[model samples]
Target: MDNWEEVHEKWTSFQNLDPSLKKELDHLAGDKKKLEDAFYKELTFGTGGLRGVLGPGINRMNIYTVRKAVNGLAQYLKENTVNVYDRGVAISYDSRYMSQEFALETAKVLGAYGIRSYVFDELHPTPALSFAVRNLGTAAGVMITASHNPPEYNGFKVYNEDGGQITPAEASEIITFIQQTENELTVPYLERSELDNKELLNWIGEEIDNAYLEELAQISRLDDDGIKREKDLPIVFTPLHGTALELVTKGLRQLNFTNVDVVKEQAAPDPEFSTVDSPNPEEHQAFTMAIEEGKKSNADVLIGTDPDADRLGVAAKDDAGKYRVLTGNQLGSLLLDYILSHSDKAILTNGRLIKTIVTSELGRKIAAKYGVETIDTLTGFKFIGEKIRQFDATGETFVFGYEESYGYLISSFARDKDAVQAAILACEMAYYWNKQGKTLHDALHDLFEKHGFYLEGMSSLTLKGKEGSEKIAAIMESIRKEPLAEIAGLKVLEVEDYLSGERTFPENGSVEKIKLPNENVVKYKLDNDCWVCLRPSGTEPKIKCYFGVCSSSNQESVETLESLKTEMENVMNQV
Candidate 1:
């Protein structure tokens, strides 16, 4: 036993832990830098799995690292499927703090390997556990959320069976069977009433929330005289206290949507969200109680979701009625111009629009003004749910997807970003811009009077532990050895660099190949239809950056997005 005497014999084998994790392993026993930051490594299930800060060592989130990451997803589904216990493992959880005892210790560590386990008896949203892992034909899926982190964080994620998240070569072969389960205190688990009496632990609630609110009412593009003229569109929502309060208020009262209000102190199920300081619905101070109940119910949209509702935040109200907030690239360019002015040009000639190369090229110029085609992943809505499962046999049709960090997806049912289908398409795009008398802030100022003033901005930077992971890998290796041919002065004419999968161009030294999936991200473009990226936030410690601009007005795209955010914080303060 070497490694610090095997972390003090695994912190004295927690002696039957859970007395508040044995008083946090006796307050980090002799505090060798807080027990080498909770046991120097071990919680690394990277490509979206196992988040931290819950407690008792080996880098937190306990129940023995959630049963060694559900026994490395039940030994990567008993060595890659063939009915590994009948292709099961759904599970879900979100109110945080030990999310239902780490989802029944991840269904008793996938019922001690004979697998099968549905779980979710309550607290749902993380896109209803990605539509309950493609409605339980599951070979994967687990989501004890850290979705919108805080309340001392918690996470686990993993998903696949095409319900997205869990790829990066199945999280590098399930972190090589969760680092060969050396000992999460001698692993093996089972006994959620003996895995629910060998039905292998079932449960599931409201038959998966009424088939995930009937696929969130086919993400409403509204009809029936536009839901009877936006059936009293007041809207206000708030689930900021976690788990989209009973399916975004019963999926907007099952679409009849009568002036909905909610936010009664963040509507309940709150795992210490205690009225926001960071339940992150992409921060507008987490919509301070849904913009003070949207200025006392005059409301015209004020949504807020976070804490596992799968990120969504809005605000709306403009035309001097006040409110504000938009940006997640202006509600993904007003929900892709209200789903391309109510779709059907034969489905906009086989539409598409997935985003995230740090989103907001004004949603790839409003999906090139309806002629659709706009892909660009690597930031994770599970790479736009693995590009809608690689264009699901290529007939093309996924009309909406977003991520400027307010995360959205209209309807591919659920492959992640779905604040209950973006709160019913953001209250049917704010009642189709208040029945044209306008306001989603006047359809984002008429899409910046037809796409020119496309401004966007983001910045992050936080540096936390291990010299902030060696200064976020020395600021992405000093921006790949200094490559900014002009940022605030605007003229970098291309650079891509998704960790050198290549793009270059820089005034003629041509290069191209970035056909995705390499990720460490960086981009540039500039010179008019301006741009800028620079990744690192694959689930925060921060580096972000983002910014974009188009100009030809809106105060020269907000002064060239504040001079490319003050030259990206002076290039992250000179790395």
Candidate 2:
């Protein structure tokens, strides 16, 4: 629909809706831009799942849209199940705007279909929700969080029985069902009170928290004795004002980390995330307060988690007496090395590591040294979680798993990324390293020397609104139509077009099938141990490009990265 027609339709529909929804619609009716933005299109739901600004509109995340999503999921479950309620669903939410309300709404919708739901009484981290699905033996799970997105945004992530995000094939089926529903308001739903009365909505809170914490505690490689000896090892932590506050602080106390400190300004959940422009831990702004606090406390390490506490970011004091934040790749490599180096040789003998192909290959090199097999999957923690499940079923040990975007999982107990668990492990790593009179920076440099120097960076081009989105699609099309045989001064050895499900070698004119499920991503491997990948953001209107380079020296690695980045920029500009 054209912009004006779409706006008019939404305005007319707003006048005809129920009183509550009509009130919300009226609030935006007078503003032409607001109306246009709200009615541009229905919110897109792909493999990364649903995300949008929370408001009342077809393009916004609101009660009607959420119910429509749940209705689709309900129908999918009913049609595919022999006993609908037997395969129940677990529901959890973070501290985002309307997150709790959305969680209850989801349960109510499930209850309307007579599908039982176990809903957390209060906000919980995303990883806990993933764990609950498997621990409670539910068929699926839903987490109401936007991860590190801005406060205006909210999202819904669907997970399968194995506690991983829904696979592409399953997500496509659900999306079909969602689109088939014409009137979102017509989707059935029960009131939260009514669902509770029917015993279809079960409130699960502290009991589950205790159980989850117990399992997390068991995964600790450090004992009370070790923690006691290193209790004074200074550590700083920040939750970025989302669900990890209580769990992470309590977990640290339980581990006997006496010198641990939480950033006071961001310790409480604030829906606005008032202190920072963006709550994403990967961005330096999110850690501004935490780093300042660390400097004052003279903390040896600084750690932060996003709003939902799924992804983790770390910073540490280098030998130069300056604080430096480590990329997800660097942190993952450190954790992988520490875990393997500290683990029993017997466990290491049968262990395996998993990471996304977009993640830095440094972890694989470390795993290789430990004799641990490394497996690569497509980007997304769900793929890593799926591999963990597969390994568990096949009796293969899962040593570690991570993605370069600050997501990591060490134990199978929590099926998704657990910043709480990561906080504990990071503190423990600091404690042991401190006892050895070394810092994380020193350890990182040592690893870099042992393995080849690996440097990686990411650039995202956000194309907001209708015009921007069309431009993004055009750029991807251009790249596909005119494939590059060389980037910078390096010859392209292979081009993996995930969307086409084929890998091509330009020099030899050879092509091979790609076994992974199809996705709209293209990766290029260069002869100089450098690689680049391009893929559009699933939940946002942005195109992301990833660059990875390896060299014998840090200077060479940085120079190569700079050259490739220039070339990639030129390609982007041309489009």
Candidate 3:
């Protein structure tokens, strides 16, 4: 068990491995480094669930690992969920390699434990899966997708009954059970025939889609007059070869937006994502085809969604009439402003805006204009979802929520971020601004003029395999052990170490508690209204740094952010 040879032998002994996988095992025999990397450790299960490259071995996202994870989830349900058989799991997958197979694997594993499962007949967006969990009154949900990752990657995301990603405590307990019951090569998975015979497997399609779409439509605030006037507003949308093609387009049509154009080349669900370098909508590169179509169609705005369709990206015409992609922060700010402008004053006063700590402060400034308070969570939408759940008793209205990575939620109907919701919002907001002789870019400039300038940027450094993991650990440890006093010549006013749940103000030598859960994140607040945060990405083999700055002008904000980024890179490199 201590060596790669032992792990390889055990895997080779598995009689039921697919023929292709067996060939793969045999093919890997000569590559000791590959074998060691494949078997050195199992994929870690955390708040994001399991994510890794697609291949054989416990460290990957093959059937055996999926089964083991599902079995652990089944055990967790049996022990915790009341009426477990009645309140089962709703399962869906995206158009990634082996995603459908992994979804089936999950259902089969749950079926083996006498738990019923509603599996999607085909691929669906991650937000739809979250909606299905609540719509079906299920105990939990499972989505087989790697979000916007590359083709080689896949993941399994777990959701609680409320349709949000499982909290840290639930992940911890499920991970414990997975470690105890996981014999990856021997994990049990029921046959489709047996599961069907037991009535434990059900295929869900249009009924759930209809319900989800209905819920999504409820979040729309476009009046008929506005829709009628702006129905012909030129708009271009792309699904980026993932699951949002139907929902995003259909949602816009339902809102009477007749001039919507779909990017024909990237419309279908292609597992390899052959159209773009990466399926991430956050990157302008993903919109290469969309932007081309936009110009040809004289589109006023362009929108695109990631593979799983949980994130959205938007492009708008700048002052010079050139199409420019909006950053996640800018989009979120525009959407917030639009939603609030359309709301009644009383509702705006009572509403609360939720955003990740790393998101731009521009959202806070916009929300403050309406007398709405902004709440900060850790860098995940689930924490924002948790806040929405808490609002039932707190009497605070959930206005809008977004993270800096293009994940957004406009309503509580779906717990996770909904690109379908964002698409309609962005288009309608564009149309609304267009009606007033302005564009999103114009609106952003107006905001900057009124509320001062704020900018946010992020970068990630990739390191692969075991060595990379060690390097990430060393970097974090070094930063924690010896904190920085300044960055980019700006004095560090405070250091918030989320891992220790402490916020220390260097000026006053006072330490206060951070009321959120402990996480391996370090944030430095500068003397100026700027800050930087560092954390390892939960789903990828990379470390991410977030920078935010505010000043009287855009030039100052941009220059300061670049300076901070350079200093951050220098510090990370030394670490």
Residue lDDT tens for model 2, 101-172: 889989989999899999998888988888898788887899999888888899989988788888887888
Error of 3 at 64 (Å): 0.5
The number of the candidate with the highest TM-score is 3
Question: How high is the lDDT of residue 309 in model 2?
Answer: 92
Question: lDDT of all predictions, in order shown?
Answer: 0.81, 0.86, 0.90
- The reply for model 3, stretches above 4 Å from the true place, is 227-230
lDDT of 3 at 416: 94
Provide the TM-score for each candidate, comma-separated.
0.36, 0.96, 0.98
Q: Which residues of candidate 2, in runs, are more than 4 Å off? A: 1-11, 14-21, 30-34, 227-230
Backbone clashes in model 1, listed as residue pairs: none
Worst 10 residues of 2 by lDDT: 7-16
Q: Rank the candidates by TM-score, best first.
A: 3, 2, 1
Q: What is the C-alpha lDDT profile of model 3 across 138-174, one tens digit per residue?
A: 9999999999999999999999999999988899999
Q: After superposition, how far is residue 523 of candidate 1 from its true place, in Å?
A: 24
lDDT, candidate 3, at 574: 79
> For candidate 1, lDDT tens digit of each residue in 404-486?
88888888868878877887778877876777788788778877888677878888788876678789889889888988789
